[model samples]
Target: MSFLDGKSLEPRDEAYRTHEITKKGLPLSAIWKGDANSISQLTVFRHFDSASVSEGFIGEGPNTVWVIDYPTLERIYYDLVVNFDVFGSVSHQILTRMYMDYLRMESEALFLSFLPVADREPILKHWYRGALAQAKVFYGHSHLLIDTPAAIHYGGKDPKNELIRMIGTRSMRSTHSARPTTNYVPSDLKVLDNLSAKKSLWLRYLPELSYVVVHDDHGEITNVISMVVNRAHANVSFIFGEEDRRIPEEDTLMLVNGLLGSYPNFIFWIDQSEIGKFADAAKQVSDTKSMDQWVARYGVRRTDPRIWSVLDRLHYYKQHYYKQKDGESEGLLDVSRYENL
Candidate 1:
């Protein structure tokens, strides 16, 4: 049977909304409009003993639906990727390729169906023409499409402009006209130093990534990291420096204040320095339950067990990862040592 078959996929029909409570005391029925719960129901179909749930609010006021599933949401995601061509836009195709590099049969099969026809055309041509640069451009385009946020989400935040600056140097090597071709000056060292404020578009979105680089004793950036809190919107905390293994107090204060002041959404990067500080501050709030306080501090949207598990995993990496001799040996960094930690 189809995934939605057993539980009729029809919209829940009830004026006051019929209620069926899960063991946890949460409602299992749909209420009001746009409830993602009604849209996607969770079910187990295999030997995999674990799964996660997801839910989203559609209309206004006190009604909503609960959507549940595995953490990866693999089934639904595969459907979306296979169906959406826009995912492989010239801007992000390259990044998408790299993101999928590690996937095996099931994952690769899902991604192969996502590339646009036009995107397919160039690669096909390159196969015949044997032009290596053309192939690189195809990959580059995919990279930008997946790595960068959409234009509508910009809200004058200049996502493209910032990327043009941050990656302009390396981008220059792709092709004369590959990226940052026109009026896009590479962001200089000075720009990187004073990036305290970030622009967010509307209340719904924030930057998906905020990157910082800390240089080593040799004056080379030895540490580079991205702070991400939102996927659809892009609110990121980016800082770079070598001497201190701590996010600057000003940056921390700024981020907290910005989150508390802005819309309900708050996003931040949780790197070693920040995680270390978090552990320290978490100690101060020890009187309170650690797990509960940790969730509150991170402002995680879901309290679901699987999501909590991922958060716990993050905590595990934070605490135990450093003790190890090589962070890279643990399925971590493969890029520059700056990115290794």
Candidate 2:
């Protein structure tokens, strides 16, 4: 606490200020008001349709759940943000990053502590593919971790995946005391979950971010999902020449419910039945010409007449349904940054 006593954050808006409670920022409002003692007291619920998601979301499972326990949280704030200088020298930046790395390693180790001890090393190995052997030792054995055995009974040979399924099962709650925080994915959209790395080789060609819409028999938008392509790396040990570490074969596709990004590389629309056929068509592409044809069939190209209409429909869905499903509405997606053929 003494370390952060001199530091203070400048308030740019009414959201972070001690103001009258509004419809937005209900979670932070609870803490500012007398309703909640801490942020932990406020219920936070999230739904992830895919295991392959952001490191912040999945860490390396369906989601990353780190046990910060107040002290670590305070340290993370002071060490990562308050202490980091944007206008400082290169050495200052590198030092801050090194401190953050050590913190991340410890936090990740803490997350792994929640899983069965036998499963810990293997998951650690997968998460840190090309790290030096000594770094692995510190992350695994040397770190101060939660020593108690995991309370949950894990199933299957793959406990990491099984844990994700368990969390998903628990979140299918019909009722919760706290207000729901985000878009409730349509149960029918579960079809996309079946597409895996083993079967869906076409996933390699997909862009980093994609907005996909599936239509019903009447040509009405039945479901909206985001396909996030996660590229695997050999290591996080360098800030320079990072591209050399790319291992495309190890990449994974994440099917996220609703619109996930502001600027999607492309938007693909297809009927429910055509999804399999679409995958097959994409999988057969041997060159750019074939790839272009596949895009012509399934994608809403920038030059297409239907592009604006598709964007409008997506925006409409976000406001009409998501505003209530989640506590807040996101800003409009700007098409100027979107990729085209």
Candidate lDDT scores, in order, read 0.27, 0.57
22 Cα displacement, candidate 2 (Å) = 39
Candidate 1 ranges beyond 4 A from true positions:
1-67, 70-75, 82-208, 219-223, 228-341
Specify the highest-lDDT model's number: 2
State in Å the error of residue 28, model 1: 12
Residue-wise lDDT of candidate 2 within 1-341, one digit each (tens)?
Answer: 22112122112122223345422222211221111211121211221222221211221243334433344567689876888778989998777766666556655655565577777777776666677573565544432332334555676887766654444333333233243223344455444443545565666667777777888887778677776776667665555666687776666665666666566778998898787776567667656788789999999988899998888877877776567655565578766656675
Full-model lDDT, candidate 1: 0.27
Instruction: Give the number of the best model, judged by TM-score.
Output: 2
RMSD of each: 22.6, 10.0
- On residues 83-161, what C-alpha lDDT tens digit does candidate 1 reach at each position? 3467468536544443333222122211222233233334334222333343334334333222222212222343323
Model 2 CA lDDT for position 185: 42
